[model samples]
Target: MRGQSYVILAIIFVIIVAIFAVINVDPVEVNYLFGTGEAPLILVILFSVLMGGIITAAVGLVKMIHLQREQKSLQAENKQLKETAGENQLIDDDNNQENPDGKKNL
Candidate 1:
């Protein structure tokens, strides 16, 4: 449901940008690091949107990779703890069996 809402919002945003871009079809001066150039307003708006999406996706990918690594580390630690607990339980059982008087060994 959350994903569906995001999709719907994205579609609506695209429609709005498309309408805005179409309304301003005049050429405009864009400043670049090296020099300045002239381009249609529609192309400029679309390019900016595309670049923003790319950067956002890249950041999301990095965060996902970090989370995956953290998850694996936690899983390994949990497995180690479980194995240690099992070993301790076995030792306790052995001690109980050896002491027929039902007295716990200090």
Candidate 2:
């Protein structure tokens, strides 16, 4: 499926990035604004990736909550419409089955 291909592509891309990072060993030093000790290249890379993932997950969670609320509202509205239609139809059926001579004619 199309989704599977996308997932495969993402995996390939991550592997490539990891391989590139490990091979090229960039000399990156991280100096925290709060006087924290400098972090090595690998640690910086991992922390950056972790922060990105956390942000992405947080955004997804917010969207999921919003979607759930919308789905719940739509389901409640559908139930109300179905009940109203059923009540109207039941009234019409009872009228049709009744006899003018006060006898059941169903």
Candidate 3:
């Protein structure tokens, strides 16, 4: 359900950008750091949107990689702790059998 809502919102946003870009079809002067050039307003708007999406995807990919690495490390730590706990339980059972009286040694 949450994913469906996101898809709907994305479609709406794309429609809005498309309408806005279509409405501004005039050529405009765009100033670049190296130089200046003339291009259609629609092209500029679309290009900006594309670049923004690329940058956002790149950032999201990096974050996902970090999370995966953290999850892997946590899983390994959890497995080690379980093994240690199992060993401690075995030792505890041995000590209980050694005590003839139903009382702990310590």
Tens digit per residue, CA lDDT, model 2, 1-105: 999998999799778768766775556556678765655576677667779979999999999999999999999999999999999999888867857787775
TM-score on alpha carbons, each prediction: 0.89, 0.72, 0.91
Clashes by residue pair, model 3: none
**Cα lDDT of model 1 by residue, 3-103, tens digit:** 99999999999999999989989999999999999999999999999899999999999999999999999999999999999999999887766446777
Off by over 4 Å in 3: 98-106
How many pairs of residues collide in each model?
Answer: 0, 0, 0
Q: Judging by lDDT against the true structure, name the best candidate.
A: 3
Q: Is candidate 2 or candidate 3 better by TM-score?
A: 3
Write candidate 3's Cα lDDT for 7-103 as tens digits. Answer: 9999999999999999999999999999999999999999999999999999999999999999999999999999999999999887767456666
Candidate 1 vs candidate 3: the TM-score winner is 3
Ranking by TM-score: 3, 1, 2
Q: List the residue pairs that clash in candidate 1.
A: none
Local accuracy by lDDT, each model: 0.94, 0.81, 0.96
Worst lDDT 10-window in candidate 2: 20-29
TM-score of predicted structure 2: 0.72
